[model samples]
Target chain A: MKRSNIAKLIIALLLAFAGYAAFFIAPDEATMHAIQRIFYFHASSGWAAMEGTAIVFFANIAYLRKRTPKWDWLAVSSVEVSLAFWSVVLVTGPIWAHPVWGVWWAWDWRLTLTLVLWILYVCYLILRGLIEDPERRAAASAIFGIFIFVGVPIDYLSIRIWRTQHPQPVLFGGGGMDPRMKAVFFFCSGVLTLLMIILICQRYRLEQLKYEAEELRIAIEERGEPQITQRAKVKV
Target chain B: MDAARAASIILRKEVRAEMRTRELLQTTVTFVVIVVVLFSFAFEPSAAEARRYGPGLLWIALLFAGSLMLNPSFAKEQANDTIYALRMAPVSAFSIYLGKMLANLLFLAITEAILLPVFAVLYNVSLWPVIGRLAIILLLGAFGLAVTGTVFSAVATQARMREMLLPLLVLPILIPLMIAAVEATDELLEASPVLDRTWLMVLVAFDIIYFAAAWMLSDYLLEE
Candidate 1:
């Protein structure tokens, strides 16, 4: 716990430093001026979402192969975190769009795909809720996670081939970023990735605690002996 | 048993059962027709607008029709516990998935064929001139829908609110398929109709990738 607290403290400091760099240090853009500052958070959230989904995909495959609860815990944690990241994307995306694109939302390729992806992952979460059994839930969600992950590439390719009003990916050579801007962007992305890891770890701990409580209840019910304490029963 | 043989056997069983009752097919055809008519009323497109938007409208209707038809692909097996019996069979789980996907594909194809002339008449579009190109596009688009819809239908069959869950799970995943289908259909319906190879290729790729993934994942999906 002490080690985790120290790590958390380090992440918090890094995040504070990244925020300072993005706002006060990075050079102003030629166009879109102050509004473009949202890009730092927006792009980092997008990267976090992408990385989270990738973790879900791999952990899901591992759960299927090993049938381990740890993998299921990891998978669900990643999904929840990923959903939060993409929610940031969806909300911040429009804020970035309205001032620049002159519309609150455009049915452009990238925006539409992201919106669809958000809905698709929401379906994944809802599917998890609808299942009653824990193992069955894990298995089913793993299968669905694989399906959703596979669809992401096709979603991206479809948008890439059929371009619309969504801006091109300027981060990667579309228009090269200034070196200082690149430093800030990478700094923000690194901080967000660290934050995603911390969130998943904390969420995984909650799932672990729940699992332990469930095991304790099962043990108590099976024992059915006279010595069990009332407090233990109530807690269980 | 070989996967192909197992798949063909399941396919034959479904076809025979479906043919005997014609229940799913009849309902789906009627549903598609009603959807097309409802859309015509809802949009009330002019000739010029109809030619531009009719293809998209047709695909939207087909998606709804396909969802209704695919919903019971596995749910009926649950009623008689036949799915358990099928699980005990020697066939691979992928064969079961393939069988259902083929069945759904055929059902959607037949409904689309019926809806096509009706749509042409109602919308006052000339489909006969580009019927060949249109058919290919429909086949690819419907195949993609069947591949994803059948898998998701199985996923939804276990859910409490299944009918609602299937479309919620399917439509978003199928945006690319819908986009490509609508675009290809739009191109085919233009005044000087020409098929867009790029969109057709997208449809084809989507179908291939999803079909392969479904085939690989069906075993996991069908677990008890």
Candidate 2:
């Protein structure tokens, strides 16, 4: 009955429809029939992941300018969400590649950049976990988040040059897509964007709950509650 | 109260301290020598193969040595809370970052100067013809490394597992710089050496972008 739940229900239905459309509505490729379907998922996930990076970039900048916990929470939520989407991209790319390229992986520019982006975000998360103070952690991670986002383009350009100079077999044959396939791809991308928003919202709520719990714990300690257990002192 | 003057003073202090005890330079040079020599044993590359791979290997060694050398950039300031003293000085916070960044760049240059001959001998690559061009690439790459490394060093110094944190935070971000440096170095090591303009441009752009980013963020980075 709630607005968010209604929105979630609509997104779930739309995602299911998109799944069906990708499988049946999209015309079969002249080459690599069923496997070509993976392109829809892979490409959409890549776009969503990039969008997530953009959100985190802005969130990080806003945090730095405002020094607010909400922006930090949004940045972390977007990073985790984007990381999941990026993982999907990483996993699906190889699945499509193993059959199409005749190998599971190649040092192609795009592929290498994807892997590097994954590693960069993973490091961002690791950096966040290492800092204990909330404000310090947020500020430090925001700075790092900005650094990682900026590096992506430079990484792409350098890797593009490196790969071009050492030309590998062209992985994706360039041809005009069928209108139906194009439509399906865009629809899937839209659906994935909605899914990403839903996931980020959920993750943001989780961070909010964490902040509340920490506040409650501190308040309890302030009240001289000797009965409060210290067992939760372990660092995450 | 000039930032440039303050930065120079900090640089002078860093130089004086290092001159008193050559800990970073001595250890880094020794470590890099062992890495370069050990790499030759590991690959046993012929002259042609060494020329093909020597630049890549040399850059890897320098990267590791740079990371090792950079770890103590801010960590040492913590030992006596000298960082707080620096912060209290009547100067912009960016000066502290610039001073440390330049100091790290100087140390990396010295380490590279020592390791270049060792790499040439072990890998059987001739450097006499390409030394000038090679120096240009090394300076650009070293500046990129120092600019980012010094900032991350300040960051990691406040974290747990500080020793392990710097490399994880720095190496992934430095991949583009590494690619440009190694590629440019590879070209210079060729039989008919010509520095490719594209990779050199990439190195220059990378150095400028990171340096500017560090300058803009220096206030936040140095905050306690």
Candidate 3:
């Protein structure tokens, strides 16, 4: 099969499975009732975000060491996609919080830290949008990517040290999670990883197209006005 | 050789400009005093809670007021495209950063210095010992802020709406530092027996880490 077909298949399967699991596979927790089911996707999206962001961070270190555009492109794609999935986790978290916590937000450490992460990524996106030079954009973003990774430790400690609805999974034995909970948690994590890969592929393709378009734009600017339609720019 | 000369020139120019009018300090301190006074309206003028909360409150007000001062601190440079001009002048970007960071640090320090005394009087606490400990914390904490704000000012220098972006970018990371500083201040204020010398030492460590990180990474950020 073509790579496109395989990518599309993976994306579809992950989304379908995630939707199915949300209503069917996952059981409501003993404490939180039906609202607790959101935890599956919430935790999964959060996991995917952390996992994908680690890729971006490592890719940034590679780019800075190598001074390669390709690595920078990869890092940007990974972060943008990670931001999208993390956005899902952030929004759904509040939905879950409203039902359980009896309020939309408290200055609880997990919630506050999550909001901080959300704002940081939003600033990341805003930074990308504001820069016109590719080299400066990559350089600035790499600097920020490295600088801001400090928050990851803070986010981790915020939950373990504070009372929060944010569940800590027993991955490396934080605590022994139940057998059934472990199964659902791992399943959600698996589905989300597949989803992250698909988004990364899509975003990387878009980056390549963007590079081509910039080349075309530079050529046109060097020459004269070309016969390009208004609709074409919109499509781009 | 010549760059050092230019750097000193930049530093002197900033110091002279600040000393001539004391505009930055005057504005920041005045704003902080008002903010503290406003706090009294919000939380009745009681003594006990005020003394308990006063240290954190002063620091919080100073942090916000410092950023308010920071936003315009580089305005003159950005307005005339002087940053580009400065870049052209063969001076190291690090020197330019040091000049700006020092200016901001002084402005924040002045504001913090004034506010601490006023906060003590208002809250009715014997503030000399508290002020001494608090001074060390603010000095270290302000260095982190200055280094961070300087680096981000370069990033924000290129953006259309910097006022909006600077806080979003800086505050998330600054949260950890603020918590540490406030916790340290609280311990000093309450005379907590558990107040370890290690925590103040941690603030000093944070100042060093972020200061070095910002300086080393700034050339990358400032590249054309």
Better of 1 and 2 by TM-score: 2
Task: List DockQ, one per candidate, in order.
Answer: 0.69, 0.80, 0.46
Better of 2 and 3 by TM-score: 2
**What residue pairs are clashing in model 1?**
none
Candidate 3, A1-236: lDDT as tens digits: 99888878877887787678766776666788788777878888988988888988888778877887778888889988888887888789889888787877667766667677777777787877777888777777777777777546644453334335555554676975557666777888888888888789788878867876786787678768754565257535
- The 10-residue segment of model 1 chain B with minimum total lDDT is B156-165
> Comparing 1 and 3 by DockQ, which wins?
1
Task: Please give the TM-score of chain B in predicted model 2.
Answer: 0.99
TM-score between candidate 2 and the true structure: 0.95
Pick out the ten consecutive residues of candidate 1 chain A with the lowest summed lDDT.
Answer: A227-236
Mind listing the fnat for each candidate? 0.57, 0.64, 0.40
Model 1 lDDT tens row, B8-64: 888888889899999999999998899888888888899998998898899999988
The candidate maximizing lDDT is: 2
Q: Tell me the TM-score of model 1.
A: 0.94
Locate the minimum summed-lDDT window of 10 residues in model 2 chain A.
A164-173
Q: Which docking band does candidate 2 fall into? A: high
Model 2 preserves the real interface contacts to a fraction of 0.64
Q: What tier of docking accuracy does candidate 3 attain?
A: acceptable
**Residue-wise C-alpha lDDT for candidate 2, range A1-236, written one tens digit per residue:** 99999999999999999999999999999989999998888899988999999999999999999998989999999999999999999999889888887888889888898899899899999999999989889988988988887777789899998874222422347557888998999999999999999999999989987986786687687876633345344322
